[model samples]
Target: MAEEKNSIHEELIDETVATETVEGEAVEASEIEGEETISLEEQLKIAEAQTKELEAKLEEAENRYYRIQADYENSRRRARLDLEASEKYRAQSLISNLLPAMDNFERALQMEVDGEQAASILQGMEMVYRGLLEALKNEGAEQIEAVGKEFDPNFHQAVMQVDVEGFDSNHVVEEFQKGYILKDRVIRPAMVKVNQ
Candidate 1:
């Protein structure tokens, strides 16, 4: 009887240990599943943060690209306009230099002549003056008429203001030096006497 009681007690203790072991294993499995879910959530959060950072970087890069494109376009437009303006005013410097020579020629042709030889020389000078004037005309240069016209500061410089007979007030009486214009730009203003 004692041995049988001992066997029954040993069986009960073994069954209780087995039941405790099973419950411990079930608790450990649940803890492991919860840990895995937390780890997945953390990984997803990290991935989303990284994605946002990359999107911001992409937008910044695109904005920089657009700004550089606009700068290039503006630079190209400025260069083209500079080229056109250079072409438009190509002959201005040369014409400016030749104006003094033309003035000297006109002075020479104004001298009094005494003989046939002097008259022939004067005729030759006149022909040359006409040719030079024609060339200037072809190049878009023109003489501004100053005599018997209204004296304007835009085209004439009044060196002397005087009372004159049969002339309107604020009109030009006499032009001492001629003025010239290249296109719409005045090269020199005419030196003139204005009637008051």
Candidate 2:
């Protein structure tokens, strides 16, 4: 009877030891799972932060690109305008120089003819004057009409005021010097006598 009691006591001690070992292993596994979960959360947070930083950089780059494109378009437009302006006024200097020669031609044609030779010379002068006027017209130079028209300060310069039977008030009675326009811009104003 004592031997049976000792055997039962040994069996109880072994069972206790096995149960403790299983409990210890379960606790260790739970600790490992907790550490893995924490690590995954930290990794996820780091990845999200990096994504936000990259998105900010991309937006900044896009903004800079749009600004540069706008600047380029403005510059291109300005350059085109400058080129057009230069082209429009290209013949200004030559036309200005030729004005005196044109005046001389008109003076020559206005003289009286006393003989056949003088009449022939006048005819030749008229032809030359017509040719010069046609050439000037082709180059976008045009004469401003002054005589018999209302006096305008933009195109006509009043040299004197005159009382005339046929002319109305503020009308140009006579044009002393012809005005010229080049491409919608006035090169010279006509010298005129305005009727009061």
Full-model lDDT, candidate 2: 0.82
Per-residue C-alpha lDDT of model 2 across residues 1-196, encoded as one tens digit per residue: 4565456555444433332235455333323434332343454455556656877999999999999999999999999999998899888788989999999998888898899999998999999999989988988999999999999999999999989998889999999998999988899999999999
Model 2: CA > 4 A from native: 1-64
Alpha-carbon lDDT, every model: 0.81, 0.82
Off by over 4 Å in 1: 1-67
Which pairs of residues collide in model 2? Answer: none
**Which candidate wins on lDDT?**
2
lDDT of 1 by residue, 15-57 (tens): 3334223545533332343443234345446655666687799
Candidate 1 local distance difference test against the native: 0.81
Worst 10 residues of 1 by lDDT: 28-37
